[model samples]
Target chain A: MQKSRDYAEWYSRYIDDELSAEEKQAFLKYLDENPQEKAIVQRLQSLQQNLAQLPPTDTSEGFETVLRTRIQIEKKIGYGAIHTFFQRWRMPFLGFATALVVFLVFSGLKGIRWDGMPTDETAVNHASMQNSLSLPASNINYTLDQFIASPSYSTDAASIHYQPAEDETMNKNQGVVVDSTGKIKQETTKTIPENLQLSY
Target chain B: MEGREEQSKGKKPSDEELIARFQQGDIYAFDLIVKRYKQQLLNFVFRFLNNRELAEDVVQETFLRVYRKRHAYKQVAKFSTWIYTIAGNLSRTELRRRKRRKLFSLSDIGMEEKDYEIASDEFNPEKYTNTVMHEKIIQREINKLSSKFREVILLRDVQGLAYEEIAEIVNVPLGTVKSRVNRARLRLQEQLKKSL
Candidate 1:
């Protein structure tokens, strides 16, 4: 006689016809010797038959049409969701993105240094220009008047000579021509001939 | 439809062949596949969930998944196994959702009590009513089984699938599938005996 556990294993296989010829013969012998196992098998078989005979469940009417409509609606909703999302935020997002790109490009061109160092040689030149404008040393032996009378200043002033042209209309008075405000004219204006007047 | 019939006349294509045709852009082949398996899948899922609406939804989702993922169906596996796997996965997801809802809703407790009241309220407390009532008892017992045993048993007896196909659908070894089916049957039988 077979144990209930072993019979449990063989019962499904026997019903399914999966047992080999030798196994089937041995299972039959086991069932014959064990009335309890035979009764169990009989009960299982009856249960299987009852289950198989249960009322068939037909699908509802228009099932395929409903499924097709659902699929169509789903596909549309999927595509429409993406389209609506882009439509809603496209301008703002594009504007923000464009501003960001522009800001990045210009900032790259301006080259903001993040490492606490100067970005260009112009900073060094600025420092030197600032240094040149500082007050002279207090220990200097010369006053402001003496510094103004220095040879370098005198020569620099003399190099800039003002030569007046031959004035056709005012050639009669050439000695320190002064009329308005009694001030000596540095450069007298030359009168151009009527035929030589250039159109500016 | 006529074009499809004429294209593959006088011989019905296998599930794999239909699937292959679907992958190659034959829309009618997909229709054929859906028609072939819709009722079977509906019955399987209905038994698993014990709810008609939910079963229909699962089967519909299963076909939609099959349509969307037709290209993923390789020729190495049987089409029935692949489609059954999809249906089973959807059913499991539904079950998990139900479990979550039951956990969160106090009303579900009341609903369960009502269910018991309904089950207990037969024509007479002393006698079995009709075949329908008996089938209800059987269904309740089947549902009472743990999901693993319930799944293997339903796939075996109710769906009438081979052990090998069940193994493929459940993604387990053939031996494991066989053992589970046997154990499920034995457990179901014991439950029925106790109820009797």
Candidate 2:
């Protein structure tokens, strides 16, 4: 009793108004020619109507009131949870936070030593540079004099000889010079430990 | 005052506009959004879930989420899709919960596999009278459908959402959504014809 193939597809689209105007006209013409197919369209329409007419279920009265109260309660519970969190862990959190802040500030104010505190050589170099920059030239000279006057100052400049490395040897003559310097370095090594001890 | 004038002039703002206002912390706008969606969501959820109480609970939870997550709504998305997605997810969760409960109850009672399908407290035939028998039949057929099919039909035909919106709410490809809706409708049509 119903049309077949493309007409059937058109029937579905026709009901939904999804068919093109030309398709709709052709479909209507097919329906007019086959009156029995009208029942099919009617059936589909009735189904759509029935579905739309299916009893709408509304929330009971005071729905908003109940919902509002519930939202309020939920908000309160949420607020309470956060409040309790702060209340319960206030001191510990404060302590941890304070400790973290203090650590950060201290680390910021004091220089960051990549390998912990500076070694004696670096500290001495830093102190000397700071004194040289900050003090008057006369004061720096006086400080240098006091530093040299110390018993820790090693005055033997020849003992601090630079030995030409093996690769740096000019010739066999250079080897003789390096041999003598090596002896001088060996002799000064014993006295250098005493100077380091006094300097520390 | 301008909004009031527009309301008096018979032009209503769109859902997106209302949601945008709500996002700006307008309490009245929030109330309007809730009022607008309450009944529609109730109907959608009631059909999805066959119980009034459960449907109402889900709607309540849906609204609760809307209130709680108002800021999560992006202006790029339709408010309807966002709210429907929330309701659909809640409905799916309730269905899953019911399924687990049914399984546990069936095991507890040592029931056979056949009775397991009919073991829900919701299947009271007494409530489906002669007057509403057709509606009851339709509801029963819908309930008999798989969740995916049922949800697609409900969203498409019952709620009259566009296929694109349904796809967005269900989080499926557009082609998949269209096919599911067509298949669901065909299946429902067959059942409806037989019942008639």
Candidate 3:
């Protein structure tokens, strides 16, 4: 009933049952004296009663079972380990390892040039050209220019010219090349004739 | 058997003892802790969120957080204080997330009346008959209170926490908790009177 100026303190003490016998008596006397405050107190009592009457919440059914299962499953999945490790070290470790890897790989590959490697198509074409250019022993003296210029040379003939350079001769006096040393030479060139035209 | 009786009588384990046992992977000790406070925790969280499933989720998350952070727990504060702090933080976070997600439409909350009716029916048949009307009034009034006042009321009246514990749980001064609870109770009374 708010007889005292400190209604909040009185209410709090009343709820906790901390008021002394004399204080509670005085408070009840005050409530009896004030009609509006008595009404308010009545309302508060009703509210408390209603709150008390509210059903007790049922949390027992399968709650602990579910919790135990969850906790077990969580433990199986490294419960706090993953979370704790990540919280403490993930960012720094990830950053350090990533930087270390980048540094090591870059340092090791410093002189390597990936762009310089021949493409697959070019390597395959080159290997095929080398195979097709295999010539007979009788035609070994014919220069690649003469062979390419020959009237019999057709589209069916592989467009590769194999030449033995002069310095590559087995017998300098004979000016002839021999396979005794198994020596071979190769050159590749792509050309467009003057009469050919291209559209962009 | 004597010690087990004392333990069952709720002679709370010392923080160091609990911590040591938990560190040794004694989940039953953790279970004891959970058993001691789970209902109160559920009530606190349920009042905050007003949804049972969400409240249960918050409780689970709170315990999980506590378990994860158990190693960091210091004895400077009471274990209940630390646990409630975790629960309060998680509840606040979930509330904020719910706000951001905009998932709590008025229509969604309206559906709760039906659920409450269904839930209350299982408790007591006679009480359930009058529960709907009274519950609606109480729920509406409680919902009208500011979050601060609502929290104090729920903690003090519903959860039956002491003023000091409420202060620790809400992370406010003890005086503030007392004043808030008183004011909230007064406001609820006023609202109830009006509804009558």
Query: lDDT (CA) for every model shown?
Result: 0.70, 0.70, 0.64
Across residues A1-200, which tens digit of lDDT does each residue of candidate 2 receive? Answer: 34365575555567778888897888888888877666567666666666777888889998899999998988877955786789899999999999999997676556546557554343443443443445443342112222332323322221112222334312222211112212212211111111122211
lDDT of 3 by residue, A14-83 (tens): 6567789998898778877876666666656556666655554556577777887787899899867787
Q: Residue-wise lDDT of candidate 1 within B63-136, one digit each (tens)?
A: 98898789988988888889999999999999999999999998777674354333445534233222232666
lDDT of 3 by residue, B66-93 (tens): 7777777787777877887888888888
| Ten contiguous residues minimizing lDDT sum, candidate 2 chain A | A186-195
Model 3 chain B: ten consecutive residues of lowest lDDT: B120-129
**Model 3 local distance difference test score:** 0.64
Q: Please give, for residues A1-200, the per-residue lDDT of candidate 1 as tens digits.
A: 55767666889888888899999999999999888888777767766766666565667788788888877887878945776799899999999999999997666556546554444433422332233223232311211221222312112113211222334223334332333333223343222233332121
Q: What is the per-residue lDDT of model 2 for residues B115-139, given as tens digits with 9 covering 90 to 100? A: 2243345445443322223566677
Candidate 3, superposed: residue stretches over 4 Å from native: A1-9, A18-26, A79-81, A85-200, B1-20, B103-140
DockQ of 2: 0.23
Best by TM-score: 1
Model 1 residue A168 distance off true place after TM-score fit, in angstroms:
92
Ranking by DockQ: 3, 2, 1
Residue A19 miss distance in model 2 (angstroms):
1.4
Predicted structure with the largest lDDT when compared to the true one: 1
Ranking by lDDT: 1, 2, 3
